[model samples]
Target: KKMIHAGAGVVDYDYRGEVGVVLFNHGTEDFEVAAGDRVAQLVLEQISMAPCVEVEALEDTARGAGGFGSTGVEATPAKRARAEAAAGGAAMGAASAAERTPHVAGEERAAAAGGAEVA
Candidate 1:
């Protein structure tokens, strides 16, 4: 099938005009609907009213704010880095060469590395 979808929308009780179904085709291939062919079907059902109750705020759940595979998305290298940063590691940005220590022995080691006497 190129594209066949079905959904329900609210129909008011006082409506008098005919309810039209909007069908669309947004696939790579073309979909043909010949005459007398079944293109779509509509299922009618009674919908009940759900009274809204007011309160300060809704209680939080275990899946609060998580959506669309947020719980399933694996931590990539970049994501891991970002999570580490968000967990207070962001302050440890790229260490500069001056701030890095490469196993320095002492003054003698520094002099030997520089090929000069330690004054």
Candidate 2:
């Protein structure tokens, strides 16, 4: 499994030391690392710094106080239909399912093929 320290993946512009990656072995098998191996990738992302103001209280919403997994595990038929519509009604297979998901990148290209890489 891939593991990253908090804020460690993001290297500041002034950081000069050698970047290090940490990996943990949770399986029963032993993993080996050679002299040079492609384990992790560096993805440069533009950071946007915005000013923050603290509010006394947050406004109420329809789903207020509902935390993670509060909406239930299964998606409703209406939700599935919305997802399929968002994917241009291509959510008929595994590849299209990935395309319908919001977090997967290059979804259209993956849908054109057969499936998308899980991780």
Candidate 3:
């Protein structure tokens, strides 16, 4: 399948008849999908039907009642900032680790070569 922009794409095996498109905006800017733009295509194959089961009442949980800023959208800004900071820190750590790896490898090679001078 092709991506309209750089978002996610999904395929549903349970859905039948007409196919549907599911896209998410993972970037900062909003994305649009135009009509007749070939969001997705599906080739019809063998069809099988199954009996559907319906649930009347289901069990509930304490957090089940929470939805849409129920925990306070005010906290979201701080949470996102902290998460971004953590991600940036992790990326930096990975870069530093990569930088040191070559040095460590060079040292090992030098020791292996009868203590020959590196560089």
**Which candidate number would show the highest TM-score if scored against the true structure?**
2
Worst-scoring 10-residue span by lDDT in model 2: 110-119
Candidate 1: where is the Cα deviation over 4 Å? 1-14, 25-38, 73-119
lDDT of 2 by residue, 46-98 (tens): 87788999999999986689998876685643466456668777436555455
User: Per the 3 Å backbone cut-off, how many clashing residue pairs does candidate 1 have?
Assistant: 0
Model 2, global lDDT: 0.60
Q: At residue 56, what lDDT does model 1 achieve? A: 94
CA error at residue 38 for candidate 3, angstroms: 2.7
- Candidate 3, overall lDDT? 0.49
| Candidate 1 lDDT, 21-100, residue by residue in tens | 65676677767667887766767778778898899988998678989886566553335445655786644433321122
Which ranking of candidates, highest lDDT first? Answer: 2, 1, 3
Who is ahead in lDDT, 2 or 3? 2
Note each model's CA RMSD in angstroms: 16.5, 12.9, 16.3
Better model by lDDT: candidate 1 vs candidate 3 = 1
Q: How many Å off is the CA of 41 in candidate 2?
A: 1.3
State TM-scores per candidate: 0.37, 0.45, 0.23
